[model samples]
Target chain A: MSWLHIFFALILLPAVAVGMIRILKGPTAADRMMTAQLFGTCGVAILLLLGAGMANPVLIDIALVFALLSALSTLTFVRRTWQPGKKKHDDPLS
Target chain B: MTILYHSGTFFIGIGLLFFLSGTVGLIRFPDIYTRLHALTKADNIGLGFVVCGLSLQSGNWAVIVKLLLIWLLVLIASSASCHLIASSGMEKKIKPWTRP
Candidate 1:
């Protein structure tokens, strides 16, 4: 069972790394933001798996909090990028 | 009892395979929107399978309930976040891949 937990952790690490690459190399700001959200989701899954494997119940709470924070961060990023009172035609329409 | 354990392992293996495919799709996809779709749908389902496997292993009512709740929360958040991000990208004119 512990080995299975380790397997999950191993898989999750590479997933996070790939997401980080997108965050770092994304062509646009929105792309990076989306990658960050993906990373957050992966983190929650990994945390929960670890908690179960290690027999520590407290980590479940941590995973829940991380999930909430990730959602809030995504909302904040969207709100920041799409601010109101800005002219839609600031640049010539593509 | 042995059958139950073997079934649990089989589900866990399948879940891992799906997760690996999701990762590969994320890397191979040409555009951010496509990658989001792969991860949000495929990976979310893969994680759901894993949670189910874990619940079976736990064999306790309280822990299984907690696992189910966690999976539900993750599913909802993953889809919502993907939608929010993709729509925001469209608004910004982030432009998808040109290749068909």
Candidate 2:
């Protein structure tokens, strides 16, 4: 039912919020980045469920965009912000 | 008709379980590699289940196809990013956590 879709969508919010702890305490940049990746996937799922529950087709398109943008964000982080064997703050171009 | 609805709910429930377990793993795992293993695998499976469930509930074929496409994109992106993160961690000389 529509309520089921909404329920699923709401439950996932806490999961994503809990994931943020990794970003706070993550020992390394990669660890933090992992949480971001998790966000991307979770976000897509949430949007999908919400779209179904609300009967709004446009939300699905937004979810698709969310998927692509999250991936792009991770790629940029890995290539530009993360420098292996060195502190990220030390990078000049980052 | 009712059976299809119930089954769809069942799949979504399973997907939620996977998502929870994956989050637990992300929190409890000892190392980056292990966390990545937990996350990339579990979450993708979870998303797949969710997609499957939503598609079952949906009457339109186009929505179903769109859902599947989103799942595939997330799958590919998550795995690739997982690999990139793991490799970069290795390059950084971060040692894996062994039982201590």
Candidate 3:
């Protein structure tokens, strides 16, 4: 019974692989970072599924932490990449 | 009942299909914005079905509450992250992909 969910967990691997490829070939830096975000969400889903399948509640807690941290990663990305006040006349990198 | 178990499995199967399509769209979509749309929308719904399926299997209040929390948290995070990514792209002035 639980093994079936584990099989489902295994099925999730290819999505992560695809996300990795996007990280590699994504045209823009934001694209790469967004792909990583996708990985984080998928990782959460996989963790939840596996925790239930294996009867290990700890994986669920880890998924909770993973979700919180993934959001942090996005915040870091936006902070580093976006410059709201710097207009066209100003240095774009700043 | 075996029928309930089968129904739960069926729900999970549907969820898996949605997840597959979402990931496929994440890669195949023409641009980053659209790709984000694909992933966030489809994957969120997919995870919903999966949680529903799992809840049916467990029949426990605490576990079900935890599953709901996980879903809600991811829901909030994905949308927030999506906004951040969109704003960053706009900040950098990345052009959207215009359909031919």
The best-first sequence of candidates by DockQ reads: 2, 3, 1
Better of 2 and 3 by lDDT: 2
Clashing pairs in 2: none
Candidate 3 chain B: 10-residue stretch with minimal lDDT? B83-92
Question: Compared with the true structure, what per-residue lDDT tens digits does model 3 show for residues A1-94?
Answer: 3898899989888877877777888888777887777777788878988987898989989988998888888776776555434334452322
lDDT of 3 by residue, B4-89 (tens): 66787787778878888888887888888898898888888888888888778777899889988988988988887787677567
Each model's total of backbone clashes: 0, 0, 0
What TM-scores do the predictions have?
0.84, 0.92, 0.89
Q: Cα RMSD to native, each candidate?
A: 4.7, 4.3, 4.1
Return the candidate ranking by TM-score, descending: 2, 3, 1
TM-score of B-chain for each predicted structure, in order: 0.93, 0.97, 0.94
Model 2 residue A71 distance off true place after TM-score fit, in angstroms = 0.8
* Sort by lDDT, top down from the best: 2, 3, 1
For each candidate, what is the lDDT?
0.74, 0.88, 0.80
Which stretches of candidate 3 lie above 4 Å from their native place?
A81-94
Fnat measured on candidate 1: 0.31
- Selected candidate, larger DockQ, 2 vs 3: 2
**What DockQ does each candidate score versus the true complex, computed on alpha carbons?**
0.33, 0.54, 0.46
Instruction: Output the better candidate (1/2) by DockQ.
Output: 2
